[model samples]
Target chain A: MKVGILGPRGTYSEIAARTEFGEEIEPVTYPLITDVAEAVEDGEVSVGVVPVESLREGSVGETLDALAWLDVKVKSEIVVEVDHKLLGTKDSKLNDIKQVLSHPQALAQCRKFLRKNLPDAELISVTSTAKAAKQVSKLRKKYMAAIGSSGLADLYDLKVLQENVQSGQENETRFLCLSKEDSEPTGDDKTSVVFYTEEDRPGILYEILQEFATRNINLTKIESRPSKKALGDYLFFIDFEGHHEEEPIKEALEEINEKVATLKNVGSYPKRF
Target chain B: MKVGILGPRGTYSEIAARTEFGEEIEPVTYPLITDVAEAVEDGEVSVGVVPVESLREGSVGETLDALAWLDVKVKSEIVVEVDHKLLGTKDSKLNDIKQVLSHPQALAQCRKFLRKNLPDAELISVTSTAKAAKQVSKLRKKYMAAIGSSGLADLYDLKVLQENVQSGQENETRFLCLSKEDSEPTGDDKTSVVFYTEEDRPGILYEILQEFATRNINLTKIESRPSKKALGDYLFFIDFEGHHEEEPIKEALEEINEKVATLKNVGSYPKRF
Candidate 1:
């Protein structure tokens, strides 16, 4: 199978893509998630991968927004572990490094480490962990190191002076696999939908949410993004704990439609393990 | 007091900063949000002005996260009514313009206008609205126009091809007046807090949320961000309807703290009109 992931190479999506399918799958990298989704929609790629949360940044709003717009659906999910390691030149000593380069998320994950360990080092956030690794590798500058994947260290030919140096021991990123073709539900599934109210009115959200409460349909997550149509109006992206075909959820959503002017079911996919 | 705002020469923030306070306030411009928050935290600047949401990009998580880390509290608010206008060179007629150049947010807000009216024109997003206007001005690039403020058109010496082109009649941005010293809450008040619970232990969220529900406290918003501490663990950023000093809110928080490991009361300020 041919899979597409977002990257310039060595992004967490690349890692997730490989992990999901192993070496048997030929992986293609796209600059943007929208392109990856478009490739699936246009049948250029069988599946696409996107991180649930951003590795370079924090949240991937643009990807989620694109998902809402696309006709494609999520088919699988994977959790990829992330550890920001301090990569340096082969002969470089860890304690003497004066500058630390990393993506914003990596810098954040390793904040506590920077505070107590290399408080004096200047922190510089870049576009990607791999880019930071590449910069340090290319420059071969003394007193410079980067917080990136150990895999990237190998890719750029750097040494991991410290292992799993992130402040948080258990840092992991959740990735979603997308496809244009629908597959049979694996029974255990998750449904994602986007809903927007008719106008900016009070108690409207309460009434809509009441349907889920009444049916005891637990919502996994809910995020509000600007509708761009009007001021104060928001589009809520909600994830519920069951497939769209499930009775309780189907019934609850049908009830919800009466209250919301816009209701679009993005997808229903089996829970990936 | 020194206030830092985004600017070039005649940008809105530079004008707004001067108009808000007299020449007594020294205003500086910072390229990134994190720098502004750091300036506030380090006491290099007395206050930092930041747009609550990016017009092209939507809400910025890194900015909010940086503000949270800086521990700087918003002292007041500034609401700027964004009047997005389509500006182009004198030689370029509106119909002849093949590309619509604007900041991402403006392009997003004017989706309907682009689709319904300028269907022939391809939309191109730029770094900033001022930059877009400047591009048209400096380059005199034919068949290209920018969606920016009317003032920007004047500054760039570009003709206004279209006026008030944003989808929302009230295309506005609320700028926070942040300070290192937490000011006394105004009588008409609001409080914002960030908290995290033991990850996905069913009913743990319910326990904290029930504290508000049982107390009849209204929650304005509840957003979950990765705590970055571990996989599956999340930090909940909540904005409630009542002030922390109020009886019900105070009691509800007291009960919430018992169940959660960490709860930080970020700030209490006047509710912006």
Candidate 2:
């Protein structure tokens, strides 16, 4: 099957795709989620891997809204540890390199590296980590380099001049596998959905949530993004620890849906550790 | 007054600081919000300036917790428009350059630029825009540059090779001015507070809101972040368009407080635009 991970060239998405589909699988690259989603919709690709945190950045809403517009199904999920690496061409040696190029996240994650090692150097953020690595390789500029991932450095034939560059040691990113087809249940599974509260009145959400509570089903995560219809009104993205076909969770959600104004099941798939 | 903004030198924070305090103000540069908060708490700086979106990134909770722990007060606010710029050392010559660095937000905001111009180059991330500019200067290498604010580029002796790198035309950031000494209210004001529900029951929050609604006070924002103590329990961060000192706001809050398990006034400050 043709699979895709976000890439202009080297990104965590590339790392994730390889981890999930095996290194030998040919991976289609896209610069944006829309393009990836479109590839899946157009039958150009069977699946598109996307980052869960991309939603946290507000762009996820655009992607989701685009998906609703595109009518594509979210079929699976994959999670990867986000490890930032500093890559430089043969010329941008550590001895003289002054500017570090990377995606903003790579830069943020590796703040400690910048502070301690290149305290006086400039940090230039690029579009993606892989893009940074590709640039370093192509330019071969001295006193300049990119901070990306080990995979990118390998892809671009650059060197891992530095690694573990982010501020938090426990950095992992979750990605969703998108397909036109739904997944068969994996016993240990997760169901992700987007739901809207029934009304502006208080306790309405509690009523909807009580459905899950009464069934003793566990909810793993919940996040709210503004609906734009009203300032405080929101669209909730919820994930719970169970398959949609399962006993209690399936029953609880049936009840929960009745109470909510809207509930769209994004997908159900094996939960990645 | 000594003001603090994001810096070693050059950044939107530096521009924000200068705009609010002018060139005469002594500005202490901080790499992170917690550090700026620390500077304010220790009396090393009179006021701390921070980007609001950075708060959304999870630092606000820590900074607020720091203030709650340190008892530093929010005195005033100064909102600034964060304009991303494509900057390079004058000699780096745009199209020839292969690496670009920037803060993550700058990079994200300017995705379209990277996709169109440096589609093949690696995009690196950095902790801050100023740091990116500084690194480029220090690297003194060829084909490397950064995207930052105009002010930051100047601070590092870089040139604005391209302007308006942000994807959004109206993209602007709001910065908060915080201090330990509380200021008397300026007429236009807003109140921010943290509150917890008495129970995980429905209508409990609606009951609290009835008081505000009755008083005709509009709530600007109400966000829930995990209390981190329990699975379902959450702490609510609320902002409303009124001064706590106002009679209606005082009476309404007094009534609402009687119903909650806990409540804390984060602050009431002039709603500076």
What TM-score do all the candidates reach, one by one? 0.72, 0.65
TM-score of 2: 0.65
lDDT of 1 at B112: 73
Q: Which pairs of residues have clashing backbones in candidate 1?
A: B55-B105, B56-B104, B56-B105
Please give the range of 10 consecutive residues that has the lowest summed lDDT in model 1 chain B: B51-60
The best candidate by lDDT is 1
Best model number under TM-score = 1
Query: Which number leads on DockQ?
Result: 1
Range of the 10 consecutive residues with the lowest summed lDDT in candidate 2 chain A: A53-62
Question: How accurately is candidate 2 docked according to DockQ?
Answer: 0.11
Estimate, for each residue in A130-246, the C-alpha lDDT of model 1 and write its tens digit.
778988999987689999888888889999888878854437677888887444566788787888875654455556666776676656666665666765666777766678888
Give the per-residue lDDT digits (tens) of candidate 1, residues B147-200.
Answer: 988878778899988887887643656567778654464567767777776665
Real A-B contacts recovered, model 2: 0.01
- Kindly list the interface RMSD, in angstroms, of each predicted candidate in the order they appear: 5.0, 7.4
Second chain TM-score per prediction?
0.86, 0.89
